[model samples]
Structures are given as C-alpha cells and as structure tokens.
Target: MALLETLVVVFAVAVVAALAVVVKTRLFPLREGEEPREDVAEYISMMVSVFYALVLGLCLVSVWDNRATADDRVQTEASALHQTYLLADALPAAQRQPVRDAARAYAAHVVEVEWPRMAEREPLGTEGWALLDRLRTAGELTGRATLSQQIAAQEVLAQLGYVDDARRGRETAAGESLSVVLWTGLIIGGVLTVAFMFLFGLERNTTHVILVMGLSGFIAFTVLLIYQLDAPFGATLGVAPDPFTRYFPL
Candidate 1:
C-alpha cells in the first residue's frame, strides 16, 4: 500500500478505538464501590505488555537483520562483478572484450530487468543463472594463452564464484519472511495489549481515551513497519540496485 493509504488506516483504527473507549465509559460509568481491583488488573496488564513488547522486539530484529544481510549480499556481488571486469584487462586480446561484454550484460540485466522482478516478489526463474553461465563461458580461454592470461582466468573464476554465492544469498534474503505462527503471535499480542487498557477503570474518561489511543496507534505503526520490512526487496526501506549501478552505470 501507498504511504498515504497506510497512514489513513492507522489513524482510522486509532480514532475508532479511542471513540469506542469514550462510548464505553459513557455507557458503563464505574461506581465508587464497583470499581474492579486495580492491583490484580495492573499486574496482569504489565505482564501482557511485557510479553507483547518482546514479540515486537523479536520481529523488528528479524526483519532488520534480513535487510542488513541483503545489503551485504548486494555489495559483495557488485564488488565481485567489478573485480571480474578489471581482471579482463589481463586476458588475451581475443578474450578480453567478450569477458567485459558479458560482465556488462549481466550487470545490466540485474539492474534493469531482474531488480523490478525482485521488487514485485516475482519468481526469478533461471535467467540470472543463465547470464552468469554465459559470463563463465565468455571468460574461458584456450591452452594457447600464456601463464599470465591463465592466471587472470583463474582469478576471474574465483571472483565469479563470489558473485554466485552472493547472488544466492540475495535471492534467499528476498524470499525470507517470518513464519505464520510468529505472525499470529504478533497480531494477537498487539490486540491483547490494547484490549488490556479497556479493563482499567480510570477516573477520567478523557485520560482513558488518550491512553488507549496512544497505545493502539503506536502498536499499529509498529505492526505496519514490520510488515513493510518483511519484504526486503519490495519495502520502502528495502535493498536497492545502487551497488550494481555504481559499478556498471547505465
């Protein structure tokens, strides 16, 4: 969803919840002797809030670490590709241009074609692997080449190995997400945390409304933030193709 739409939903839920608390207090005012036991309620509420906070922390950490790993993969892949490109200079005259061209083509495909697919959470298929294979084929040299050329070819292969590993890491990161069980816990926890506020019988209806609204709004924002970060490539704070562009500007 767009930022504006998300904000609207968050604010709408908060306002509706706050209004419900208002109506609830009006309809069922707590009498002096009828007020629920504050001590027990406070204890339970504190425990629930603490557990919910733990869940939120776990979710935030999971997504943040995934994003950081995705970023690292991008940097590694781009650096390896750049190294391969530079190594092409030491190759034989007949082989140098092909290797460089293949490197450029692979970079272009990643930045222009594959990036959008990743952002859309679409299947990458085998196109990227095929491109990488082509790069490997282009770098191949005959036994007629000298020792230096052979050594350059070996270095190029090593760099391509890094690129392959990093690409795999990147793809895995793109598909990674919290499991359904964790998601269920997160949602249930947030709801219970917010609902606990309703059990309290504060003297001022205004104060009660304010507390519920603030807690609900903050929880809503946190959940949404986690959702956005769950998609490492697609989210607003997602990994970018800047590493590729920096190495092979198009």
Candidate 2:
C-alpha cells in the first residue's frame, strides 16, 4: 500500500511538472529572432547529466549492498541458533531441555517481537540482550562434566557468539539509511537534469512536451526506487524474516 501511494505521488508530481513546462512554452513561444544556444546548453546539460548519473549509481549500490548484508546477518543468526538447538542433545540430560527451550524462546522473540520493532524503526531496548544472556546461562554447565559434554557446551557457546555478532549487525542494518547530504544532492540533481530539457529548442512543441514528460517520470521513478531501498528492513524492498522462520518455525 505504501509503495503504491509513493508511486502515485511521484507520477502525479511528474505530470504536473510536465504540464508546467508545456504551459511555459505555450505562453512564451520561442521568439522568431531569438535562437537557443544549443552548443553551450547541450554541453552543460551533458556534464550535469553525467554527474547526476554517477551519484544515482552510487546511491543505488550503497543501498543494495546494505540490504544484502542485512539479509546475510539474518541467515547467520538463524543458522547459529539452529546449531545451538541441535547441540543441546549432547549436554547432560537434566540441562538438555532447558537449553533447547532457551534457544526456541530466543528465536521466537526475534521473529515475533523484535522483528516488528525493527520493521517500524522502533527501539529494541535491552530485552533481546537479556534473552541472549538467559540462553547463555541455560547452556552453561555449573558442575563438572564429561569431555563430550564439555565440548558440546563450548560449541554451543561459540554458536551463541556468532548469533550475538549477527544480531548486532542486523540491528545496525535496520537503522542504516542514506545521509542527508546525498539525499539533497539526489533531489537537486534530478530537478536540474529535468529542468535542462526546457532550455533546449525543439522544432515542435509536442516533441518538447513529450521529452520533458519522459525525463520527469523516469527521474521520479529512480528516486522512488532509491527511497524504497534505503530502509533495509522496513521499506518496500526490505529484507524479510524468512531465515528465522525457516530455522525456528514460528
């Protein structure tokens, strides 16, 4: 729904901009005596276009990489939790169920509680960390144990460490976004790129209108795409929590 709303708004703005350009041309039709300096105008517009393309490409790549990294972190966290759950069998009979329960609880919390908060860009507070600590406590053996139990405990701890690291990465990525400076550049550059179309002298007014409409629509769509990708876990192009569900089956 949000994505559809965004698309409607962007396209509406583009249409309005195109109409404005057409009205300006109709009101002040290029006078017979005046001629557009195509040489200078084309050169400057070309330079502006090149620079804007570079910036657009950079923004796209940055968001794409961040989203991919966020996805990887989720997978790693889920995989580690699954490993820890499996290792519970090797622990002492008394501690086995507790450890498995802890692992399940942690996974469930992440999928049900923490995920919605991340999606909404809300603060996760300390509950997730507290749950992680509880999982660690459950897996640790207080008394002396056999070699196999000791090894299993250590492996569980190691898996938990991976889960911790991945969780941190996931949290960081959830809040990651493009900086203000880049956003300003993107907006200003797109405007300039489209505005340049009006300066060119076209033999037919229809041609001029068509060109402006196409340019405006395309630029608006690109900006919208970047905006959607900027929110790694909340926006239209965000990463899903399928990894967690795959391993821990909510």
Candidate 3:
C-alpha cells in the first residue's frame, strides 16, 4: 500500500483501539480498593515498554543499516563502471570505443530501465547481463594488442567484476525485508503496550484518553517509519539512482 494509506490505516486502528478501551473502562469501573495492586500493573507495563523499546531499537538500526548498505552498493557499482569507462583510454584504438560504448549502455540501462523495476521489486531481464557480457568481450585483449593494452584489459575486467558483484548486491537488497514473524511481533507488541495503559488509567478520563491517543499515535508512527525503511528499494523512502546519474550523466 501507499505510505499515506498505510498511515491512515494505522491511525484508524489506534483510534478504534483507544475508543474500545475508553468504552470498556466506562462500562466496568475499577473497585475502590484496587489501589493496592495498581503497582503490579504499572510494573508489568514498564517491563513491556522496555522490551518493546529494545525490539524497536534493534529493528530501526537493522533497517537503517540495510538502506545505507544498499546506497553504498549503488555507488560502488557506479564507480566501478566509471573506472572501466576511463580505463578504455589505455586500450588499443580498435578496442577502446566498443568497451566505452558497452559501459555506457550498461549504465544507461541500469539507470533508465533497471531502477524503475527495482522500485517495484521486479527482475531486470537478460538485457543487463547481456550488456555486461558485451563490455567484457570488448575489453578482451588479443594477440595483436600491446603489453600496456593487455594490462588495461585485465584492469577493465577487474572493474567489471566489481560492477557485477555490486549489481548483485543491489538486486538482493531491493528484495530484502524484515521477516513476517518480526512484523507480527512489532504489531502485537504495540497493541499490547497500548492496551496495558488502560489497565491502570489516570483519575481523569480526559487525561487518560489523551495519554492513550498520544502513546498509540507515537507507536503507529514508529511502526510506519520502520515499514518504510524495511525495503531499501521500495518506492517510498528508498535510495535513489543518484550514483548512476552522477557518474554516467545519460
């Protein structure tokens, strides 16, 4: 779903949950002597809050790191392609233009075609691989090439290897996400945390309602943020193709 739609759903759920708590409390009021055991409820709530906080922290760090790694892989791939293009200058006149053209085509395809597919978590077809093969073939030095040209060819091959590795990494990252079990924990934990607030509420109903609303809203916001960050190449809050555009420039 779109980010705004997700947010609306989350907020609606939070509001409904808060309203349910309010209605339940009004229907069954606490007993007069219940103060004696209120501390226990508070302690349990505190523990749950701490545990949930830890889980949220860990999830946030993991998703943020994954996003950063995805961006780095893009930059690495672009740099490798750029290096391969520049190294063509050291190749023989017959071999130089073809390699450069192949490198350009690969970069163009990645930026123009593959990037959009990645946003949708779709596969880039054999065309990109075919372009890489073309670049590799063009960089191959034959019997007539000089020693320097042969060395350049080897260097170009090495850079191509880097590009291939980084491209694979990018593709893997585009499809990466937090597991379903973890998502279950996150959602259930948030609900339980808010529900616990209703167990031992404030003296004033208005104050209690406000507290529940604020806490639930914050939890929903955090969950939404994590969701957005989970898929590094998702359409929302995803890494852009700036690296390719910067290096290749069309």
Model 1 residue 114 distance off true place after TM-score fit, in angstroms: 1.7
Instruction: State which candidate, 2 or 3, has the greater lDDT.
Output: 2
TM-scores, all candidates, are 0.82, 0.82, 0.82
Angstrom error at residue 109, model 1: 1.3
For residues 19-39, could you state the per-residue lDDT of candidate 1 as single tens digits? 997998899888968965579
Q: Rate the local accuracy (lDDT) of all candidates.
A: 0.88, 0.88, 0.87
lDDT tens readout by residue for model 3, 1-250: 4545666776899899889979977997788776545676799899989989888888888889889999999999999999999999999998889988998899999988998898887887889999999999999986588888888889999999999999889988988887665676688789889988776765567887888889999999999999999979777889988888888887
Residue-pair clashes per candidate: 0, 0, 0
- In Å, residue 86's CA in model 3 sits off its true spot by 0.5
Where is the poorest 10-residue window by lDDT in model 1?
Answer: 1-10
TM-score of 2: 0.82
lDDT of 1 at 87: 95
